[model samples]
Target: MNGNIRKNIRIGATVDVVLKKDQPTGRLTRGQVARILTGSATHPHGIKVQLQSGQVGRVKVIVEEAPSE
Candidate 1:
C-alpha cells in the first residue's frame, strides 16, 4: 500500500523510501524501518522514518509489514 499515512507504517516494517538526495530522481531505497519520525497521523509527502541501515527518508511504498510477535 501507499506510505502516506502514519498508521499504515510500523517499526521494523520493510518499505521503500525516497531519500532527500534521491527525491529529484524519485529513487526508492528498500529497508526495514527502525524508527518513525513523522509526528502527525498523515503527511502529504509520506511519513518520515529511519531505516535499519541508518538511512533516513520519506516512505514511498510499504513493501512488507513486520511480522507480529
Candidate 2:
C-alpha cells in the first residue's frame, strides 16, 4: 500500500485492513488497518474483496477505481 498507519487509504492503493472471521456469501465484517505488512508495499491489488470480520488480518485489495466525474 501507499499509506502509513492510521491513514485513510486512497483508491487503487493497497491496504492492510483488519478482517473478521464470520463472513457470509456477500457480506463482511471489516475493520481498520492494523498495519500494512506485505504485497505491493506500494499499491493495492484486488478489485473486489469479501473479507471476513472480527479477526485481524491483512488483505492486499484495492479500495476502488479513481472517480472520473
Candidate 3:
C-alpha cells in the first residue's frame, strides 16, 4: 500500500521514502520506520517519518507492514 496515509504506516514497518535532497530525483531509501513525523491523517506527498538508520524523509511506499504482536 501507498504511504501517503498515516494510518497505513506503523513504527517498525519497512518502507521506501524520498529524502529531502533526493526529492528531485525521486530516489527511494528503504528502511524500517523508527518514528512517524506526520501528525495529520494523510499527506499528498506522503507521511514523514524517521527511519531506523537515522534517515528522515517522506514515505513513498509501504514495503512491509509491522508484524502483529
Candidate 4:
C-alpha cells in the first residue's frame, strides 16, 4: 500500500520509513507505527510517523496495516 496518503495509514500499521538523518542515504527502516505526525490528508512525499521503536520519519511503504477494530 502507498504510505503517502494519511487516510490509508493506521496507528498500528507496519511501514517502511526513511529517518530524517537517513534521507541522504535513502535507507528504509521497518517498524510498527506508534503515532502519526502528519496532520494533512495527503503529502507530496509521504506522511510522517513515529515508530514503536522510537524512530521518527516519513513512511515510504505500508507493509501491513493494522486490522480494523
Q: Which sections of candidate 1 miss by over 4 Å?
A: none
* 2 or 3, greater by lDDT: 3
lDDT of 1 at 26: 96
lDDT at residue 55 of model 1 (Cα atoms): 93
Q: Candidates sorted by TM-score, descending order?
A: 3, 1, 4, 2
How well is each residue in 1-69 modelled by candidate 1, as lDDT tens digits?
A: 889999999999999999999999999999999999999999999999999999999999999998899
lDDT of 3 by residue, 5-69 (tens): 99999999999999999999999999999999999999999999999999999999999999998
Could you list the CA RMSD of all candidates, in the order they appear? 0.5, 8.9, 0.5, 0.8
**Pairing residues by index, what is the TM-score of model 3?**
0.98
With a 3 Å backbone cut-off (N, CA, C), the pairs that clash in candidate 1 are none
Q: Count the clashes in each prediction.
A: 0, 7, 0, 0
* Candidate 4 lDDT over residue span 1-69, tens digit each: 998999999989889999999999989999999999999999988999999999999999999979889
Give the best candidate by lDDT: 3
Summarize candidate 2's per-residue lDDT along 40-66 as a digit string, tens digits. 433342222223333444343334423
* Superior by TM-score: candidate 1 or candidate 2: 1
Q: How far is candidate 2 from the true structure (C-alpha RMSD, Å)?
A: 8.9
Error of 3 at 61 (Å): 0.5
Using Cα atoms with residue i matched to residue i, what is each candidate's TM-score against the true structure? 0.97, 0.27, 0.98, 0.94
Q: Distance (Å) between predicted and true CA of 39, model 1?
A: 0.3
